[model samples]
Target chain A: MNMTTRVSRLRGDRVTLAHGGGGRAMRDLIEEVFTDVFRPPGREDQARLTSEALQEAGAQLAFTTDGYVVTPVEFPGGDIGKLAVCGTVNDLAVGGARPLWLSASFIIEEGCEIALLRRIAATMAAEAEAAGVRIVTGDTKVVEKGGCDTLFVTTSGVGAIPPGRDIAAVNIRPGDVAIVNGVLGDHGATILAARGDLALSTPIESDCAALGHLMEDVIAAAPGMRAARDLTRGGLASALNEMAAEAGVTVELSDEALPIRPEVRGMCEILGLDPLYLANEGRAVLFVPEAQAEAALAAMRARPEGEGAAVVGRAVTAGRIPVVTKTAFGGTRIVDMLVGEQLPRIC
Target chain B: MNMTTRVSRLRGDRVTLAHGGGGRAMRDLIEEVFTDVFRPPGREDQARLTSEALQEAGAQLAFTTDGYVVTPVEFPGGDIGKLAVCGTVNDLAVGGARPLWLSASFIIEEGCEIALLRRIAATMAAEAEAAGVRIVTGDTKVVEKGGCDTLFVTTSGVGAIPPGRDIAAVNIRPGDVAIVNGVLGDHGATILAARGDLALSTPIESDCAALGHLMEDVIAAAPGMRAARDLTRGGLASALNEMAAEAGVTVELSDEALPIRPEVRGMCEILGLDPLYLANEGRAVLFVPEAQAEAALAAMRARPEGEGAAVVGRAVTAGRIPVVTKTAFGGTRIVDMLVGEQLPRIC
Candidate 1:
């Protein structure tokens, strides 16, 4: 089927209250849009995965949750669906686990277009497939027009941590190196542009790709990797602060080595926002042993998602300043979690 | 802290744009409400559980998702929070698993009362505690005013199924009896009354209790139980139809044996609705061997959540009708899923 055009040709132009009704209409809608996209061929009620499978796999599950309420449901290079899948998967991946199954819950507005819903579902299907994870089960609820924006998706994921692999923010040591996979702030810039608040013609696309596959390789290469966290919500700055606080150490970043897109930097410069604090769906902050920094960088650069990976900084001795960024101009600035969200609903 | 009046005494009277910003305000709000209620005392970021616990327990995981957008966030016997926890836990329980941990994702509207949110969180804490499950992880997002209703909650739960316990709708067989854990339609009716859409003042409370403990007993008493489903949005009628359709058999209900309350029946009658089709939050429809039906009922009745448990019907050999209910008037009528939702956002 031509997925691109199929969504537009759906029967209803706008969702009605009846679509959310747990009845025939709702069932047909789900069958046409959701089940058709997520389920494999010839499976009925594919949501129900048996416990026997988990038992046989000897799964040591790492579960995490994320809420996506990005305004302008469709954005440059990514949509809410793509971000939802990647965000949750990355959460599990950073927690030292091999991502497996996901449960998605959608809150849709009554006036949301049926076509838009279908397109989002298609995007989620493709992304889940690309990430090698399954969207095993989901729930959908539609509310009145004023009740919500077009759509909000909440995803909870489960992954199995490989035996003997321990990952936690507390694992970082004073000498550990901090590495980021790919250019940061693209997701923040993309969402900003999509909202049309800046009215800039910048071509910054969101870096909202699943990083589980890349993390899998990184973990294998650097067995002593301390921990990892995706740059989301409050971004790289928040992540560094969290790691430092949890480990009770000081983290220092070399701004010259940071990987950032020029367009994103430009957008932030004009918008009075900091790239260090912008969300990145695909980027991850990995802490590795100081001796293995070069090897870890090489492993990360070998993957497409991590081709731009760089060693941004290192954990220094415990100090009063938890995080500091040494600027290219030969000065340093303390970095802390934003007292208030600079951008809301970006994820 | 007095959980009763603690909510109203919170510093902020209403949720603001910054509350969802992933900043200090958000952290404080969560700590005062969510973490305060759901977490163990004196823990930082208390919403994470180690996979080692699950591994030691030998958990065979069952994961399920549900979104709660029930209008009038506060209902008669329960609020959206209580319903959200019970709803997800019941999903796993009815799947023949012992409910364990849950991930709660909340979408809040700007200007939503902080006191209201804390109250909801308190209710959720109570419900999760009573159900013997942990609110292990969650995400919170806020939208601009008019972007959403007061609040919506999406919960995902994981549970462990005991060894050798296999349950699925496909396992249902001819001559199997259908048992309902308790009274039906109260949840649907309670929401309607709470919305003030119905001018009825009957003290009809939602049957929104977590049924995992009771289910554990029923499963032990009736190891031959074929399958089970919670009667949520579409209630008992839809469940029976689904089981029959899946098992490729005819399901016929004895009208006289149905355990619906007089108040619920009267509400349905006045609303021109069928109690069989209304939703039930704390009810379960179990398919079991007819010979063990009595034992199953006894096991269910031993618990308060299942006190009204009764044999409502039986599955027969393949027939033309998927579901048929005998009426009190000595007539048989086909029971199908409602063509449209009787009420939107009832759960």
Candidate 2:
């Protein structure tokens, strides 16, 4: 753990094939930039982990992984590093697991700036700390220029789920209230603007925060919570459809009750996009029994990451379609799963 | 898992941005190609795992990750998918853990052939099944054409280490014996030939195989085994140097006793490469007490993956350098860590 003793041995400002050759250069880059920031417990090839949570009787391990290939490595509110950590963390959290440990592997293109990598590592470290997880093991590989985009990160996480807590889409029941944590499409809108392809400006930042803590709070308030899905790539619409299909129920959404930022709405309108299917990194739809809906909403609203909490829909008895939205004018329309790409590399 | 119930709904032969957008296309590709092949237990974002091994008192978890970006997605005797699984599994096995589960994430280029992806997935499934592990969770991201090579895969693994077993380089003693499972450099040589840059064809095939069962057999025979390291990117020389440095001892190898093929030796000589530094995907250097060395060798030689097992060297008192070799001519020479790239993306 004496990181200071391993002074910078890197000789160049950018990555090279040698840095991934399992040689002195690779060791130098890993030690100075990665190990120094992440501070894992050992230099072993694999991390040894033990926790009281794992020792508990009937405890289950939750494992998930995500690959981050965002267009711009660094975005307004978060970089690929933060997104990688948060995305994996949220995946675990939504499954009702206490996010614990993560392993991050980076595929860096040769000639990528060393400074940028350091920044990304720092951001990953900060985000992991805030999320109460340790990045215990990692690997780095440098590909030749043009072999890959600047950098891509794949983070896999392991969490512990307490005994008797079964949360899954199949557990969702009719009459369960669906709640969203915040306004949708901020992340998608932010990335669209950041790419500068649309030639429009906006003061929007990605809502790319980790939701483990918020989930813990809501679970505490509503023990009857059935399931939760992070509104990520396919957004709320896709999540709802999947949940409905799995539970063999129907999801009815109150279109007017959906919370969306003015800028995101404007961007969707200008681009002829439906805000319902736009991705959101930090948003999720939670299904709680009707009796505890108010408690879940209040618990979510109490957290900064969930200040925009609102009840957007409910699960009803099976109908012709999986998901439908009731408009402000009183008519209902199918809100199907996204058919094709509206935006690529949004995560 | 009722995989047959979900028939293929794929529309095209090539992957497009729509297949990575978390929509219907993505679902179709994942279900028909990935989920049907892997047959995970659930459709949730994370896998819920429970095992008697994890519930044991004093048991510890082992976690590791690696990114595979070998130049040719498909190489002689193996593809990136097979390499990805074996690399991570070997990392955990060498740490004295029984690898239990794996999470695979792929960054695939747009327009990549779907048929090729199916082949990779099938290979991964077969390998995981042979290794006694499950590919329980995964993610896929599609990058724009030219944003990445045809494909890159990153795999993370979780394993269980029973109580009282601590295998690490730091455990090496002055008299520990070093043994290798087989000949070195076949994987590196095979990749070099597969790339066709040298236009030199040889009968060499990549020695890529999972070594978890082999390690288990060795440990059962030699309970006092000190450490084990997979001879991966930097091969035997680098692994020895690392072990020597960590244990504060010197490693002395008998150059006459090194097991290497004639074709590999010729390839190394022609390319000005050192076979000692050439990578091996299925080989490992194991350290055992002198008394247990014979037992370890017998156990390894009994396995198909380790039929070429041989005593390569022994740890000795600290010398001027961390690693050295005794030549056939009875002269000693230092064998330091590799300094730079010998073969890029040799994985």
Candidate 3:
């Protein structure tokens, strides 16, 4: 397959309705911008994949999907393409699966710059390569101007879970220790400032990184890991509350022990917002047996993506509230699920 | 697991930004509308799947994806949700895979009615059940009112292909028989009329149907099937051209043998369009060895979705033109790929 010849066939600087019409133009754009970078095996309608892990006796297939419509398609640390890949990878990784294959579908509004699309595709290719996942199959659709924002991406992934790896919120025990991989709210804070809606500028960049490798290491260190959840939309507060409810226990967080950057904290205070509820793309909370807490933290700290790992909380017997935080001021406060929109399109 | 209480928590008449904010509103909407209908096994970030087919010694996994942004959101025969499900299923079916699991991601515009969303979700549920595939995992994002049209759906699917079933265009050989399951251009014609831009009205409905069972039956009958392609975006002409190019053979279509409705033909003539270039969602082109062509046709005719199946063309020795049509007027003409948009967002 001579990609050069195929890519040379593209004749436009911007996307038009023709690029999504299932015609020559559409083929040219897809082959040049996507397949050229991803290099899928065949031109077949579906990608045919084979993996030894899939044939394992008790391997379970893990499937996940996410739609990315973040405002300002490109941000300081990452673009929507990067988020699309990392978000789906984390969804599978947090489930105790070895992330493998991804499928990306793009919905582009007419008149979007072709160069921008190429950049997004390139970022996706780079992210997939870094995470050791193959982008196998995809689709593209074009809508008239005003039919959609510049572009939106939806990525779906499939992975394999080894036998006896039963990771779920219900498996969390009362004595389980909750650990976080990094500082919270970096992504949310960056996006809020990037949007320029509040005229507040900060040097924060999105903490958007793939956690597959970090997760694999943590599981290896803590063989009895109970559950893990990515701190995406709704941040740490929502995740802790859900985990507590599922296990019918209470999660108590130590405010001082929680890893939060001063810049993020300052931004939260100025906006009268709770940092715990701000989103983070690269952070996740893991529950492990109390004995393995140190080992889990050590494993996480050994990785660049988890260098800020810390123990923030622990599960206790059922109480009046599912989650509570012990404040630095020597008082405990209930932390409940967010009731309304705090930050839309934070992801 | 008691869905009644979860559903009772929803409190809204229309979708707001909060429903997508990863808060209580988002949880209520997802649980009541999507999870309740799809019934994914667990609340984990990913769906854990296990299948005996996946464990077969030499089986391969088939993956495909598609994004649907058809205008009007609803047409006579289907809505965006139905198209989202069937489009991905046919993509896998054409690859000779037994479609099994699908993940649907939705990009919704704010201010959309909750009642309409329920209708769309219900339609997707019904379609997946009929296709014998599970809606295993999904994600939803909401944008501001002008960020997108009412809604767009992207569906990615995985299936299993038994060993030695290498159905691909490159496998096609000269003298292979070509067949189509049903009418061409019904979907395109229906959408055009439904758009109300041409001041035309017709009883024509979109031919949106899942062909997984039909493909399975045909494969069983004709074990020597060469290749199959869903006649979607660019219709039969484009599919035939692609197959011909891949196999280095010439495809000759008999104009009189094509299964086209009178309404579609009339509409095409009035609008200066070619029926061969119009899209069909429920139709597919299949190639099989001459010996098993009769069995393949018989198997297709036995199914309701393929009752209108007919032999329409054949592959011949390589020629100057990859695709040509034998007109009823006793002359042959080149059938080139569509150069520009005939119909956008038809699917």
Clashing pairs in 3: none
> Which runs in model 3 stand beyond 4 Å of their true positions?
A1-7, B1-7
Per-residue lDDT of candidate 1, residues B1-347 (tens digit): 54565543334588888888766677778778787678742122223344433443344567888888888899789899999999898888888877888988898999999889888999999899899998888878888998888898999998766656678888999999999988888888888888875678888899989988998899889989998888887788877777788899999999899888898898888889999889889998999998899999999999999888888899999888899989899899888877777888898
lDDT of 1 by residue, A127-184 (tens): 9989988998888888988788889999999776665677888888888999998899
Worst 10 residues of 2 chain A by lDDT: A1-10
- Of 1 and 2, the candidate ahead on TM-score is 2
lDDT of each: 0.83, 0.94, 0.93
TM-score of each: 0.93, 0.98, 0.98
Scored by DockQ, the top model is 2
lDDT of 2 by residue, B1-347 (tens): 34455445898799999999988999998888889899887889999999778778888999999999987889888999999999999999999999999999989899999999999999999999999999999999998999999999999999999888999999999999999999999999999999997999999999999999999999999999999999999999999999899999999999989999999999999999999999999999999999999999999999999999999999999989999999999999889899999888887
Clashing pairs in 2: none
Model 2 chain B weakest 10-residue run by lDDT: B1-10
Specify the poorest-scoring 10-residue window by lDDT in model 3 chain A: A1-10
* Candidate 2 displacement at residue B301 in angstroms: 0.7
